[model samples]
Target: MSDDQDQEQDQDRPAAPGPGELSPEMKRSNVRFALTLPLFFMIMFPLCYITALHLPVPHDLPVAVVGAGAAAFIASAAPALAGKFTLVPVDTPQQATDMIFQQTVKAAYVTAPPGQSAHMLVAGADGRVMTQLVPTVFAPFAAQAGNTVQTVDVAPLAPGDGNGIGLMFFMLIVCIVGFMTANILGNAAYFLPMRTRVAISAGVAVLTPIVLFLFMGAWLQILQGTVGQIVAVIALGAVTSFTVGLATTALVAFLGKWALFPGMLVFVFLNIPSSNSAYPAEIVPPFFGWLSEWHLGAGFVDAVRAVLYLDGAGLGGHLLVIGLWFLAAVLLVGAAAWRKRAAAAGEADAGDEDGEGDEAGPAGAAASGAGPERVLLGRVHDHHGTPLPGAVVTLVDHRGTQTGRTSTTDEGGFRIDDLPTGAYTLIEAAPGHEPAARATVVDHHGGGGHGGRVGDIRLVAHEEEHRHRAAVATDGTVPPSAGSYGGS
Candidate 1:
């Protein structure tokens, strides 16, 4: 048979198995990823929640004793309440009230004037559990004096909010929605510029808080702060959303598909247990109490509580911590973008050097009496048809052995030369994008200087690819070139 006829026959034959063919290595990788996710959730959920919340005992919970001889009274009662209450002596009831408003003390006990029952002042805005616990701890002293205690709630929760934790639940919803929004943008909008993604996140941050504030504060009437105080809480919510979203985006940029593990670890696992929303920090375990001092959620909860109930006590410190988080996340995202741009520039430069010899066509080599080089080349593009620089192109033969690997140039072009004629799979992959594969025949006898050119290979962003796969699964329709090959 003539060489032309043989080449045509080779081209006509099927180059690889049908779509959805997975190599052994790919199967193992999929299984490992699947198992790792459930295990991660199992360990993190129980470890953080159960450990922090199992048994809550107050550690040096601050309380004030008011009126004359209060110091002597506390000193006499110290042994009974050792390690549980940190009692301070105040000269009068007014001073104790001032201390409570400033959040210097959680609650206060006032000694009765000659015959009246003693007063126990508590802030119901500080979780109800803490409010209830305070009076119980001071009940013995009141009983010894042959007087009962009259509990007064200085800062009470809104009548609509029975549990006083509505804001905490609202903050959690805002945070989780912000986090998921950023994650979705990272995967689905991978082709957008970094600044655009950041802007989108900022928009979400602003909008989420305002909408939730209207629902939880205006519509539900669960929040009982003044207009300015409510605005302050809304501002804090915006900061929380922006900070968490940007932090999650940075993680996604650096870790790709594995970003969720650390993102959830920081924002959900650690943040929730230490937030002091359900229990006061002093009542929880020491580790979580320490975390409450600086953790992101803790800062939000503290600042909101201060604004709504404590007359903005300790507000500056909590805002400072949250601001620091926003700053750190901004820096991390900038670094990720810079790193990606630098790596792409380096790969483009390398691709240029590798392409130098390819300018001489295969015809030139054939004329020189040397055998034609078996080179395979192509350009990669995103779903929008823009060049995708730094995309990885890997070649694997029918035996599942990787034959060559190269990254795309600034123009999204790549070349792999000196291959033995065979049927092979070309795999294209890039960060935050779904990998794609197609089969092609590389026959030296095809009469061209290059063995083959697979045309432009387009890759879809992860979200789009996922949707496509879901559609395919539902209809039992096979997508073209959905096969995976082994890698070295």
Candidate 2:
């Protein structure tokens, strides 16, 4: 049979192996992927949530007691309370008030002169969960002096936000949005260029806080902070969420679909429970307490509490933690992209050596049964250096008449055999990737088929339009002006 007849016969048949012809390695991989989903979702996910919210008790909470006489009485009568509280005794009520604003104390009790009622001051903005715990633990001590105990709220919750638990809800919302953004961006990485993807994700992350701040401060009147402080805290949160999303997407792109489990385990399972919103780290298990010191979720809550209620005290450490998270995520994603490029370069080098040995001389090529007709050969790759299989390649002559057509193989390679010796426009098109056209001349006498080889054709993606629309929805314009706040 002629070469044309043989080529036609091969094109009519299946190119890849059917399911029954699967290799043992492929079968094991499929089974492992199936099992991983159930293990992470069904077992680990619920277990983490239940363990964190079930039971919580104050372990080493901080509170201030005014007056030396009251401090001595508490040391003698409530020794347990002294151990649970990092107690700070001050001479006057003003000093105790300073401690609450500094976040050195969660609540404070002022001792009455003698035979009078005691006064308790608590910061309700420290989240309702812990705010309630502080009074519940100290109510007994307040009753020792007199029957009447005056409970005063130093920092109260927003009028609209009935309880301070709304802080926890906002934290959860930030995390969910972050992970969802990462999932969408990660899928886009397969088609879009790396720099474009990074710019889109990071830009959106930086802008998200502005809109959230406007809603929380200007519109909702929930956050009791100056415009600058509110913007700072919310920006930190949005950047932290952006980093988490970027890191998760990078892991999945580099390591495959199974890599999602590790991201979920760290960012969701561990982060949410240890955030110190639902359960204070001081009152929870040591494992979660350790995570609270560094996790992004905890950082957002801590910074928000410090800015809104604690007079901006102890916010530096929380902001540092969030900055570190963003820096580390950027490094990880960059490393993955670098590694992928290096691997593709290595493979291309090996292919070049083989192609060089095959192309000798046209006279010698004819002796070895190579025809006079020149052939075109090339490979298609995405922006990330990933092979794109089943991509269509069409050849058109100078007049735009269709000359030949072929599809990329399972290895992302294609060769159109027995082509006429002439100039043609080679168009490489693939799903998700941008279609590219290049002009090339094919001649059998040119370098004995060595110079005719098209090394690698890279394709861009059509993801920018989708990303732009989404960004507009989240951050279309600047937020409204914030209102002034008064301290109690």
Candidate 3:
């Protein structure tokens, strides 16, 4: 009896998965997915949250910009012009008392006229980034104007600050902090209405950069630039992170996967290498520099240059690029989500309308064992009842497993088929349309094939969707970089 029973039990068991049996095509796909996945998220995720305004520039500090030279020096040293800056445009010595008064420049500067001997003004500020850039900005202008400009700082650097590397430290810190904070937000999500979620997101989005920049610069004494400037740069960092994080969410949803590795790949590879803050793109390989020109880091680099060097801004274009990227990501992701929601809603409205017209008991609907049956039929169309094409419908069951699928009407309605006759859920999706979902039953009484039911799934494309925003508004090619722009 025992042997016979064991043989019978063994025959009833399911076959096991094959060992090392992955096909060549499957292996290649897995390998490609492993490689391409990182590249996709790296570029797309961080792209959503970036913004130009959030860039940080250290604010609040004792800075003295004293110059005995032309006003061009002051202009070149605009970023480093510390509190109560004193600018002596003409080549005359400025009194210390006067500098203490109107705050004319952080310190005072008296420029020597053209053909005059070189003379340097002495002033000190806590930041070294500013120190390096002030000289660079003024040097070119002075040389062009036929004057010699010399700078001397009387104030000493802070204990935490490096000789000339503090700004780089701040930039690195800002990026690191922003990236982590963004990750935290990406994790804490819930099922709130779309509009409410957007509002909440905007608030969080606004605060992330402001707080991070202020906390880091103030705590670390990251830069000696004015408090306002530091705050600006920090803001830039935060905006960049938020946009990136949101885009990351969209991608994860589309891939129907966890957000971790894809997000990490984005933060690590493309974001870090192309930062261009660690090393100027100019000195790096062609690829590094080229990448720098496009990434948020490029704006960050230019921003740091503005806050530290005080001369090489290019803020308008750099910030514009970052802002535009975020704008585009928001629209793209928002549109996709909207479409999914609208389709689901369409099915729900059909059910409600049908209920009022012809009463049907739940018991009767349930009696057919809810077998692959369609107890309901509906149609989706424009307000004028014209059937639309190319709409995608996703069918979900009680357990949330998708069971049915179809496209839009040739005339203007929809039919959902091949399901148990019981209650089920439907989700519809279309680009540029708000998403809609609902629960319903199928026509399964006639068996699997015959059970298919037609229900119109109607959706209207958003008015805004009629025209997409321009990624490149200008018809012209970008003026060639640095050299071609006519200034080095």
lDDT values of the candidates?
Answer: 0.70, 0.62, 0.44
TM-scores vs. true structure, each candidate: 0.71, 0.67, 0.41
Q: Which has the higher TM-score value, candidate number 1 or candidate number 3?
A: 1
Ranking by lDDT: 1, 2, 3
Q: Candidate 1 or 3, higher lDDT? A: 1
Clashes of each: 1, 0, 90
Top candidate by TM-score: 1
Which consecutive 10 residues in model 2 have the weakest lDDT in total?
467-476
CA RMSD of each candidate after superposition: 13.1, 16.3, 19.6
Cα error, residue 132 of model 3, in Å, equals 10
- Weakest lDDT window of 10 consecutive positions for candidate 3: 478-487
| C-alpha-based local distance difference test score of model 1 | 0.70
Model 3 per-residue lDDT tens digits across residues 202-271? 5565666566555545676645456666567666766765566556545433332244455555454455
Over the stretch 327-373, how does candidate 1's per-residue lDDT look in tens digits? 99989988776765554444334334433433222222222211222
